[model samples]
Target: MSNLAILPILLPFLAGVLVAFFHKNLIASRIFSIIATVIHLALTIFIFMSVQESGTYVLEVGGWEAPFGIVIVADPLSALLTMTTAVVATAAVIYAPKSLSRIQEEFYFYSFFFLLIAGVNGAFLTGDLFNLFVFFEVLLMASYGLIVLGNGKAQLRESLKYILINLFSSMLFVTTISFLYSVIGTVNMAQAAERVGEVEQQGVLTVIGILLFFVFATKAAVFPLYYWLPSSYTVPNAVVSALFGALLTKVGVYSILRTFTLIFNYEVDLTHTLFIYLAMFTMIFGVIGALSTNNVKLIIAYNVIPAVGFMLMGIGIFTETSIAGSIYYLVHDMIIKAVLFLLIGAVTYAAGTSDLKKMGGLIHHYPVLGWMFFLSTLVLAGIPPFSGFIGKLLLLQGGLNQEEILIVIVALISSLGILFSMIRIFIGGFWGEADIMDLPKQKPSLAAMTWPVGILLSLSILLGVGAEMFYPAVSSIAEYVMDPELYIESVLKE
Candidate 1:
């Protein structure tokens, strides 16, 4: 069954290639994309279940040995993330047909979409550090194509900034990987994890670790490095925006979680401490941006930073419980963010604008959109009875256990700010007088788009209400990540 690890990557890569050929036939393209996503989701679920029941599966390429050949390892963490990516990407595909323009649909949008999934899955599952870099490039190139799908001027300008930053980040990643290989003598993650502890110049190793982290932090949009996200995220159409918002940044977070725990495990005192402070500041600055934004898209985009901060908090605390909370929180944020973006997209469609000041009293007319938006805000704010609350609760508990008083306070305060910003959106966009001037004369049929939103919203509810069932799995994943000895043993064995 270890071969199943490669299926997630191969399925999407092949499907995407096939979808590219159907670009001229929009109907065929749509059907193919939807079917492809559904099949991908099913396969991902099977892989997740198989991993849980059995153990981590590592597939060595070309019959080569460990630390010498490319490998894809499907551990619990990677499997869960891949599953979440599939779900979110599937939703985006379902929503894209109606949300995206005809030209955009016909111009290989589905191809790039599946390719992005392939890259993401490959990134999640690959055991080789250089292969990880390779996967990042694959996903990023796909993103570059996806972001400019419509060929709009705003999309081009913002995508340019987005591309430039990612390009720099990629260069840094390669440099760090090169430096790491020079220091550790291998580009295999498990090998590096074992070899890093034996290196003589621990100081140099630590510096390289920090540098690599900074590269990922830029991608994850930690404070001071996050200025490009909001503007670039908002320029794309809602489907593309939602996809970017949900999956792309999480890849960075996933990398951080993987590397900090796996390869750079020796310098906990220095590296993890840096994460704590960075997480705190990231939370503060991110929510401030969220509260200050008037554009609905930008508001949501800004919040992604703070959410990243919250996950970083768990990592900083660096306990099994804390790591568990962070994993749960990461998954929760991915789902809820997708829900929020799609909900906001629906409102944008109805109003023909994302400006909060120019829109009002949407609930009186489009009550479905209003209520869904309101509930999703609560989820985003970590209100009770939602998945967000469970994640927040666990993270808070983890922080308290670690005696991180300042971050706990910062997180609590940031939660309030998040609530305030989201409430502001609710009040400004969904309440008060119905402003028909800004709204579309012919309200678009939200029937198709709403299905995906509703599915995600329900899933968010399930994650919260069924937290007990999930706690064991999340706890197991955390344990595995924090202690990668078994992981390394499995990957290196014949």
Candidate 2:
């Protein structure tokens, strides 16, 4: 079990190397990428089950001990997220060959894709803060390659902005890590957690905590810091865009969860209160952006910001039920965002533009695509009988329990705006008369593209239907995350 913690990160790194050798053969590269992700997914499942049965698993690199040498830790939270990353990455690879241009496939697309996945897995499973920063760099570098894969003017321009913003965030992350290490003399998160509890200069620690919060919040695309996201995301092709929309920002939120729940938790009263307010602004601003955009990709991209806010709200509420709801929502959003981005990509592919005004009555020919878009929109809006509903309900219950009436109200109203924003896209892009006479008719392969969307949507539904069974597991993850002693013991013990 301890050894398995390294497989998720190692498989992808090795696969990336193997795929780089076959980059000229798109078919071989695609096949290799898919197989690698499938194996990673299987490994992640085994890790998840192992963590469930045994509590946590830690792998000390080179047999070096914790608080000194590198370690990989797979607690329930990391295991769940690693499994989700594998699932999403598998779908992206399966969808890639069809969505990517031939040049992209022939180049280093698959190589960088696996590199990105490896970095994400490493970020989730690493036990030390400095290594987490290292993984972030790995993923960000790979994303730089993937974002500008085709080298179009729009892709290059937007990719520059994405790169610059992340570069700045990376600098901030390093600075925060330095400050933290200077204070505690350790980068291992569990050890840092132990030292934080014993540190007497909590006022300085509180400032460091706030700085760390800002660093992670930037990656998560929280308000003010999120200006780079919608534009950066909308410029990429749907496959890359969908993958970023689904996974990247969530890693930031996951980092926030790890930091606030473990190392920097000495000042939750001060720190969590800030999260609650920022979450309110994040949701409101995100909805406003969605309401203002008629571009299908931009609307979907903007929605990702608010979903981050919702998860943060759960974190800020800081209850087991609320955190569990956030974890469940995180899983649901990964599937839903992928579906929405892919579906929108198909629409724009058919219509030859992302502008909703240029697209009309797509359902007349592609009824399956239209309905998938419609239902996924509702699932995103937290409609009843969908997975979003249960997660939102638990978050709201947590807010009410904490007497955060205003936060609850903001969340409720934001749901209305979310529904409105998505419905507008549906009516304009799918329901109106076909105005696409001048556009070229090179539609993407429906069977190829739509099947992946269908698979993701099915997962979304299953998350809702199976919530009764899954909730307990996420609840346990929440409990484990909130109390870091179990993680410390598991990682530090000889």
Candidate 3:
């Protein structure tokens, strides 16, 4: 069963390679991509369930020992995220055939999509830090192909900015990894942790930890560094935007969460405190960007930053409950963000524009889209009895328990800011007069596009409504992440 770990990464890469040659038979390509995604989702679910039952499973390549061979570890956290990634990718694929431009469809869009997802799963499951860097490159190259499929002025411009920044980060990442290897003698994460404990995290190692975090933060779209994301994501089509918005940045955050908790925490007083302040500012600046935007895509893109901050809030507090809350929140945001972007696509399809000022009274014509968009705002804002609430409650509780009063207040205010920013979209886009000029001449098949939105929405509802059922598992994941020794021991086979 442990051997099944490679399939999630390998299956998609093979499917993508196979699909690449089917350029002429688009109908055949769609079928193949859909089948591939469905299987990927199933594989991830099986791995998730197996990990829940069996604890972590580490697969070392080439039958070599840990620290000497490359290893893939399907721990509780990675398994859950990979499962969630598959779920989101499946929905994106289902919604894509009719939604993308003809040029995008004519090219190997789904092929690049598969490659990106394979890289994402590899990032989550790899136990080696250098392999993590390799996986980042894999996903990024795939994303570049996806972005350039647009070939429009905006897409080209934004994609250039997006690429340049990631390239800079990648260079810095390799340099930092080289420095880390020199000091620690291995890039196997477990070995790095073991060696860090032996040397005690101080002086040059602390510099390496912060430098490494800086690289991940850039990828995660933490503030100051996040200026690139809103513009870059907004320029892509809805499905691409949804995938980038919902999952890519989360990978960066996942890297941060894994590293800070596992290998970079000896100076918590300095490090975690920096996390709190940065998170606080991230939430503030992110919502400001969201509220100021009238472009529907821009609003959604900016909101992604605040969600990143919210997850970091849980991490900065560094409590078991807070970590649990962050994980729950992270999962919830991934689904809701996907739902929101898919709806953005539907809305623009019906309205023929992304500007909210030119849009009006969509509910009168498209009740399902309007209503779902409205409900999604509630979920995004963490209103009661929905998916976003429980994780937020736990985070807030954890903050108060630690007597971190100021940051907690900022988080609360930021939550309200988020609700207000999203409601503006609902009110402006769905509630006004039906402007005849704004409606598309040929009304889109809202039904075709929205089924994916509906599937993800139901999952979001389940997550919130079933929070108690999920509590024990989430807590265990929190425990698993908080203990560096467990990760080190399992990966080292000690």
Q: Pick the candidate with the highest TM-score.
A: 3
Name the best candidate (by lDDT).
3
For every model shown, what is its TM-score relative to the native structure?
0.98, 0.98, 0.99
- Root-mean-square deviation of candidate 3: 1.0
lDDT of 1 by residue, 1-494 (tens): 77999999999999999988868998888888889899999999999998999999989988898889999999999999999999998888889988888898888888898898999899999999899889999999999999998899999998999999999999999999999988888999888988885663388899999999999998899877999999998988888888889988999999999988988878888899999999999999999899887999999999999999999989888999999989999999999899888888888887888888888888877887788888888888988878889889989999998899999999999999999999999988888987644555676678888888999998988998899999899999998888978888989973
What ranges in model 1 sit over 4 Å off?
199-201, 435-441
Ranking by TM-score: 3, 1, 2
**Position 52, candidate 3: lDDT:** 92
lDDT of 1 at 71: 90
Number of colliding residue pairs in each model? 1, 0, 0
Candidate 2, lDDT over the whole model = 0.89
List, residue by residue over 1-494, the lDDT tens digit for candidate 2.
Answer: 48989999899999999989878987777777888888888989988998899878889999898878999998899999999988888888888888878988887988888899999999999999999999999999999999999999998999988999899989998998898888888899888889898873388888888888888898999987999999999988899998899989999999998888887776778889999999999999999999997899999999999999999999999988889888988988988888888888888887778887777888877889999888898899999889999899999999999999999999999999999999999899778676544644664457788887888898888888888888889888888887878888888883
Clashing pairs for model 2 are none
Q: Of the pair 1 and 2, which is ahead by lDDT?
A: 1
lDDT of 3 at 237: 85
